[model samples]
Target chain A: MITSISLPKVEKKNDPSLAKFIFRSIRDAWDYRWAIETFVTNNLCRRYRRSALGFYWGLLGPLMTMITLSVVFSMIFHIDIKSFTVYIFTGLLPWSLISDSAIEGSQCFVSAESYLKKLFIPKLFFPFVIVGTYTVNFLFSLTSLLLIGMVLGFQWKLSLLLLPAVIAVTATLILGMTILLGVATVYFRDLSHILGVTLPGFFYTIPIIYPAESIPEQFRQWFLLNPFYYVIDLYRQVIFKGQSPPIQDWAVSIALACCLLLAGLVVLKRNEQDMIYRM
Target chain B: MSAEIQIDDATVRFRIYRNPSPALKEMAINLFTRRSSGEVLEYYALKNLSLTIHGGERVGIIGLNGAGKTTLLKMIVGIYPAFRGHVHVGGRVTPLIEVGTGFDLEMSGRQNIYLNGTLLAHSRQEMMEREKQIIEFSGLGEHIDTPIKYYSSGMLGRLAFSIATMIEPEILLVDEIFSTGDALFVDKAAERMLSLFDRSQIVVLVSHNMNHIEEFCNRVIVLHHGEIVNDGPPAEMIDFYHTHIAGRGSNASTEDRSPMNTDFSVASPSTAVSVQEQSRFSMTSSLSE
Candidate 1:
């Protein structure tokens, strides 16, 4: 592995082929697996370090958001729908996973200035840590939502068996986006600020608060263009809607994730060496 | 399968930007106007440097500030990629540069031990095995559970030092992290460092301390303005470096003399002794060794 040994790892000026870049990257990640584990643990620990509620806050925060949004839309706005709390809960959970991870991941390299300056850490390691930490948090909220949804007269379907696959696809999508944004943010520090402003726009436009059908028929095609909508829809199909999504949806979601991941790897490979000096 | 490092015709250039990164607004404006958003001051940090260190060579690198001393160490560590030429390293490199650098302040001293161990690419089980030794050496005791942010600088240094030294390095790279902890801890650290040096196949030490170079290194490379000015035995290189580089540079300005003199007293107690006279004693002793 590249991280384990220092020899045969020549530092040259030319960029390697994409296949070479990916192969070496995976080896580096595997070699630094313990680091990823430690960073994720530290990240989660730091989040709840001084909080009185601790890990319970992870469960309660989403529950409280579901309640507030359900009350606002169902009771106040009177936009009546069946199992509305569970519906929004399903949508908001995945949406938060994507947006929150992206916002944090965009600054992963910039924030790791201290570590990067001093060691030979794999460039992909930071984004992997972000994705790992967020996925754990996502799983926690998912468990709470499942119990709460069941209590609210929502039926569980065997389609829930597909939830793991859905999460894999979504997490893959987030990891790709995180790596891409993280590398870009190193060269352009404004990318994180841009994400802060634009991610909320994504939250509004991606139909997280309302069902996809709620969009007017003329403007609905734009929703199909969004890469995130497919991943979120995959979750809603399995968890909230209690039905198996079409194979085409699965194909599209997986393909989108693979493409982003490829792009992210490409950008990272090209800029990996230059990134240290840029920082 | 001994350790080796070959840096051939390597040129590491650094670009210092007036604005490190361009803002989005500035980027957009530059795109429209076809204007450069910032002025870049580019220069070579390591200029056409070619050097090779084989197994069992305890090499010392010495130079004035901005002479690419640390840059050379970092380049070999693969932290700084060369802009030109090739750098081929032939063993596991363990850089002791900024030992406690990436410690998470919010984590406890014990937790940081594992965190730092993993960062150095040691496995969890490996760290677990050394956990007792590390904690005992750090001497943080019950304070190991408390967040490291609350620890005094000396305590933090001790913890960082203990964790960093717990490695069986094949090619050890040291960059002046010697002066940590109190007198007692420094003695312990120096002993540990000497043993580590003895075990490594290749050792490259970068220091302004002439005494350390004379004592520990068999071979010495004197870097001047990113190029190797002299490469020879430790005593000879130290004498050449002091007269040609440090002395000339110091005479040009007094600010450069302090770093060369800071650790010079360990070699000789008398302030009246000249650098040449001090090196002459070591020349005879090192030749005999």
Candidate 2:
């Protein structure tokens, strides 16, 4: 069948430059950008299509979880209501991006195998769609976090200008992990299952619920090594504590993201052609 | 406006795992413990097949069930990496293999037009501009707004056929997609396909229906076993295919064994480069992984 069959010109170029690959990958994904946006919107709509609140249901899930954890943990620790909500807000929203993308994006390649077999779509496309869908929700939650802080007389500092940079670093880190897991899951069926069990375990270890101060001094140094510590800590500082992130924090975040992304791209490039056979 | 292809002695092999999916945990433990989780079989779907397709050529591929018709298409599309040779396609190539394959059944047929369009490599604006024409041609009318799952299979096929034939891109490769819709719609589909043929620089069709191939193709290739057994004029090769290739299973008489003969032959393609003497597009590194 011949539906609008325009294709990107393919040539056997010997020893392609790294920049060429980057351009092609981005271009391939961009060419299918409409399809990606449609899927993302459909996913969001389908989740709450039958609900009375419609798209607002995206906000409710995180809001409800945030409320439940804030109430229970605040009561247990005798923490102030305002400060407790801020902690959960800073940590949980970003944590949801990582967790949701890891768990959902793991199945992305496996689930979209039919399309891969049919069209020469880039393997990176599905991960972008899954992460993009969740990132929209993450943005919504982030907006509410700022709104609440403003209502509570929280200061908006010049450091707030750095939020987009933080977001870029955060998206790069998760997008790398999500794409990596997406590829691995095509070969390993239980990857999403492993993710389902390990994410909660990973969460408790990250000090999302409790403050960094609650950690024993003996274990504090090791906690700093968690790449997410920098991300979550940066969130808290800028949002709750109203301080700019240190240059070292920015450096480590970007460097780690770049490392993971580089490795992820290599794995994707090697495995992409074989994915159709596996499926 | 042109597609130049040279597949220099390509061999495509598939490693079919015995297990539906080997448990990753067990595979990992086996790696550590030096044990095999399951048996795997590696076999060639296409072996040492070489061909050159030039611009403005219409080649039709006819073969039996396991004769690598689909694999050949995938090899050119670069989905199935060649194990031992190079597949150099110098032009944009559009594949119509497996029509409506990636359509989301729950989405409306109208929305799927955009999704399917982009998958076929058309941009959003292109789909938008042609939306009315596609709807009118598909004749789905109001049903286009309804979920595709609700549409009857004939209606679905019609929609797919309509979307597929909406535009003609360079180097179109079609596989047995023309014979599905209703009789009148099939006529319309055939008419549209003929128009695409006129516009496309080169077209490769793989269909079991010999009549379509006889009418549309200028050149025909009969694939038997894994290699091209014959390549020549459509009418003559098609006659050779029926008498020899297709006749082999039903009848029990030995026929001519020459490469140029109308019967199934043991001789290899004399035109192809020998495994020793490498062509320009020779595979240097093994793509075995």
Model 1 lDDT tens row, A11-36: 45667888998999999999999999
In candidate 1, how many Å is residue A52 off? Answer: 4.3
- For model 2, what is the alpha-carbon lDDT of residue A59? 72
Clashing pairs in 1: none
Per-model i-RMS in Å? 13.0, 13.8
Instruction: Compute the lDDT of residue A222 as modeled in candidate 1.
Output: 88
Where in model 2 is the C-alpha error above 4 Å? A1-20, A68-78, A151-155, B28-34, B251-289
Q: Could you give the C-alpha RMSD of every candidate to the true structure, in order shown?
A: 8.5, 9.5
Docking quality category of candidate 1 according to DockQ thresholds: acceptable
What candidate 1 gets wrong by more than 4 Å, as runs, is A1-12, A77-82, B28-34, B251-289
RMSD of 1: 8.5
Each candidate structure's TM-score, on Cα atoms with residue i matched to residue i, is: 0.90, 0.87
lDDT of 1 by residue, B1-289 (tens): 7888998999887665557798988889888998776556555678899999999999999977667777788899999999888899999999987677667777788888898899899999999999999999878899999988798777887888899889899999988867777899889989999999989999999887789889999999998777899999999999998788877843435523544423321211122234334333322322232
- Among these predictions, the greatest lDDT belongs to 1
Q: What DockQ does every candidate get?
A: 0.37, 0.31
- Assess each prediction's global lDDT (C-alpha) against the native: 0.82, 0.75
